[model samples]
Target: MTDDTIKEVLKRIPYGFYAITSRSGDDVNAMVANWVMQTSFSPRQVALGLEKVSYTYGLIEKGGVFAINIFLKDGADALKPFMKGRSKNPDKMKDIQYSEGPETGSPILESAAAYLECRVVRIVDTGGDHDTVIGGVVAAGVSSPGEVGDTLSLPDLGWSYAG
Candidate 1:
């Protein structure tokens, strides 16, 4: 599918919004993605499909771990700025405001509804601009109430994906 069509299809797939994060040395990166999902329950695996060019992807490849913070609708306004921008900026995490993950160096946004710390178990090239990263969850917990702000969805917001 073309990038537009692929994004359109993906939009139909309901997803919990998340800011997946990773780091390499002082280079910390975080990207907002809606394509992440849990792939397994027995071993507690989660799959995150991120573009090959993402800074977070490089960090996961080099550092071997990643963290995910499922965002809440209440904070959607807080996350809109970082949704579509080059991640080379060292201060990309500035607006994000977070603490380091306990197990991984990944940044954990305190505003998230829930968070998960994971180690890469496999990385597969999904033949598009994105790679399918399957990881095993080491730790996970809900920071706020066991519920998200508003369960934001694409249809609910009427946004067209271009990034």
Candidate 2:
């Protein structure tokens, strides 16, 4: 298949947009991420495809924990500040309102409808630009009740991260 064809197919896969937060001691960060999904049910695990060189990746690596902040469709605007990488928006988390997750101590965005705290179980080198971080869910909370259909997604913001 051609590159354009591959891009088209990759972009066709649905993805949800989220603010992924990480912390290592005094350092903290939040970034926009779409490559997140649950990988297991028994132990409750989730995987995140994180750029190997990203600032958040370093924090997650050093701290061994992270949090996934899930927003509602109406909360799409809340994630805009994190759309930029740390190099372009170094202070993105400076003024953001958030609370520390009880288990991981990662930031949980105040505007999030729900949040999941996870502890790093493994970081796999996939021979790609991104590494797959497998985390076991340690804690979770729902500040605002909602169904899966009420969550915000990449398409809802007219953005694409695949292909």
The estimated TM-scores of all candidates read: 0.83, 0.97
* Candidate models: Cα lDDT each: 0.76, 0.95
User: Superposing all C-alpha atoms, what RMSD in Å does each candidate have to the true structure?
Assistant: 3.1, 0.8
lDDT of 2 by residue, 64-87 (tens): 999999999999889889989899
Pick by lDDT: which candidate is best?
Answer: 2
Report residue 133 deviation for candidate 1 (angstroms). 0.3
Q: List the residue pairs that clash in candidate 2.
A: none
Runs off by more than 4 Å, candidate 2: none
Error in Å for residue 43 of model 1: 0.3
Model 1 C-alpha lDDT per residue in residues 43-90, reported as the tens digit of each score: 999998878987777888998888887765666775665576454555
